[model samples]
Target: MDNHEFESESYEEVEEDDVGHDESPQVITIVTTLPSARSHRLRTRLSLPDSGYEIDNVQSTVSANMLKILKKTFSIPNNVFLHLSQDNDLPSFPPEDKVTFCSDFFRFGVRLPLHSFINRVLCHYKLAPSQLCPNGWRILVGTLTLFRSMYNDDHSLAEFQYLNCLKASVCSRWYYFHPRPNVSKFILDLPDNNKNWKQKWFLISGSWGGELREDGVVRSVPTHFGIPGLIFVLYVHTCSSYASLHV
Candidate 1:
């Protein structure tokens, strides 16, 4: 979708009392199925909010936008997009896509300039085009700044569903697995008995076999969830740790 199309739609101004509310713009991203002879429904509607669900969180719209933007800039010489698309070895660094920089690893392999890094990060996240606004840009700036400071390891990605009674149902279906009994127990046992809560870990283990490096210690790198899933899992584990301590 183009900026003009997004701007045409109207939104009602929501009034706030005392506390500040999230200011990221709301977007109704419509994903239309590729037309086939038998297809009747033209499109599907997905309303994505900026705060919780980052751009990369949604598969349909955000991914589509990435593909679009990627195609458009793929030819730019000496640009990250160009390097990502090139086949042969080049003197310049490959595109940002090849690099694994996130909130966790700030000044790692890539030495992207502040604006360049921000642009690329936003692109990777598939943030809305309008986030270029002063307020949204400020938030984006702060987020990136924080990422640079905490480069302990790779920044893991997680998908956090807003807290509510129906959270169990939401999470169960999302993970495509049945709920474990310990889910409740895990929460009840939160660290320091923080009732307000934080996150819950999605226990996942699969075939990324454990191996001993040159040193004898064994390290098991997970193969199931990528950057996105890892982020969500980290959040859950962090929150659950605090919760468990209390119980």
Candidate 2:
């Protein structure tokens, strides 16, 4: 048989499966072209409001499929693809805030924007204030790098800079000011000393001191002691909490 005859036979064989089946139009469309009607189908499948699929169960498959679409649709470079696909731990669907942000961002794109469509995208991944650990920081850095690759225009560059500044500000506040010593321990333990010595150093440096305000706000005392002082304070606070728990 000629090449055309072989291709026609292959198409007929594929259609033969659908002959007796009662497949919905949606199923047929999803199987044919994901990008053409992606927004509606994906949103319905993901079912954000229904608590549909467990995040862990769907994350890998959803991310892989969405990344495939993004790479093809945007003609993203291989380097850019590597940057996004490297972080396998990112959620399949981002939080509502990021979903909203991305939906608005891509409103004018070819397809009708769906919040879930944007939610599946890697760039929309957001780290919670409490989740600002080493791994989370790596994700954020990777996301910023990906944005740089995706958006090369001057306007987008400014926006990228703004995002970086915002991330840095949020991280500094959570890492430095928050009372979660265990979370901050990695940085706090950097000084070359034992835990006891570190605690004593915190006491001596006046970094352990804070003042309670009328509004029930406790502000750290600014000793002008800089970064070392901050780490000492966090170390002492974490140690004290653990000690209290044991007692």
Candidate 3:
């Protein structure tokens, strides 16, 4: 990956919103009964007003868009695409065909400056045409800028799936073998609590909380009920002391 591919997009580069940071995500309210999804209609048809759902909370199109970006990015470098076409050594970072990230990480329908988005992507997570190379070197998309030097720490790579739920299929992501569980069916360090989760987790595939950004930005984020799941956040505190780190 080239350094130019990802840029540090601070507020300076992008037009700063006159609102607060916490009010960055877009939310939609569905007032009337939602219509069942059909192939012929535009996705915008799903955005119902009044009845609310946090469109970003569950992704239906982001996986496709992100995947498309990675695929396109991989093909940009000369011979990179031609090379990875033969092997998955350039492993797809998350590898899973589904999405694992929750609202705590990425927002939907929020239009950000190109540099800003690039900076956010490089904050964490690796990207590939569709594979991880033998050297374990891959491009890191920053959560908020990555130096893009293709650094690889085998130890860190080994734990990639652990820290990231975006690594596995929904069903297995909450299993005993997983490092973390995004679903309420499981709890960290409490393996016993996750037993028979297959029976407990339901596919209501409905219910999305609506958020009105404090920044006053409105976005029409696309969504679907295909992979219905619940989000259960787990907080771990080993000590009473608090410390802050700067990068």
Candidate 4:
């Protein structure tokens, strides 16, 4: 496809609007892509009617109700996480507003732009937020590592996801974040004192994972996809949509 040429994808219909609301409808136009086996994007421009939202001098807080509207429009789950188009920023999920939520992204200076849903991602979450980040308690409670404990509820399928090696009825749940950069070769968050973590970083990926040695050895196992075409795709497609907030 050419850079200027566009592709269109048909999306499902939102339910009929109820007549009982006193406030007129509001619209939120969203353009996002789904994860699949194809190269093309599944896109839509959804108008959220009466989708409650709030804005202040400092922040924009979208209503949890909008999740329902989005699910209706896109045939996705209401609890699915919504990213502000930045693959690095922590995604927004249920029970919290998109902007005001306390997140790793905010702690690391990742900001939200206006029209955040533009090129945003609708992610299906399987793990808790704390699990995704981590708060320490490794030995007593177990390190919050990245192996799969898929929340698909069926233990057999979860086992299948983890190659029957680690994900067997584990107490943790699996979550999906898009693939990040530099897994095989380099990078480290560098655990400090009690601020972020107490111990050295433990490396975790898909079905395979490992505890990194203090000597900086590559003990961690490979992810589902290695440095093949996926990493190249991410490298080329790392987006700038979440750059800054619109004033």
- Candidate maximizing TM-score: 4
Tell me the tens digit of each residue's lDDT in model 4 across 7-51: 121111111231112233322333444435864344332232322
Give the least accurate 10-residue stretch of model 4, judged by summed lDDT: 114-123
In order, candidate lDDTs are 0.24, 0.24, 0.23, 0.23
When 2 and 4 are scored with lDDT, the better candidate is: 2
Q: What TM-score does structure 4 among the candidates reach?
A: 0.19
Residue-level lDDT of model 1, residues 71-152, one tens digit each, is 3543212333211121221111111123211211121221222344443333333322211223323334443455557653
Show where candidate 3 strays beyond 4 Å.
1-165, 170-193, 201-208, 212-214, 218-247
Provide C-alpha RMSD values for all models, in order: 21.2, 28.0, 22.4, 21.3
- Candidate 4 lDDT score at position 197: 24
Model 3 per-residue lDDT tens digits across residues 1-247: 3344333322122112321223323233222222247621111223223212222122232233453454364332332221111111101111112212221111211111112332222222222111111111111232112222334312232233233232312222111122234523222232233222122111101111111232566321112221112211212122453322111
Choose 3 or 4, whichever is better by TM-score. 4
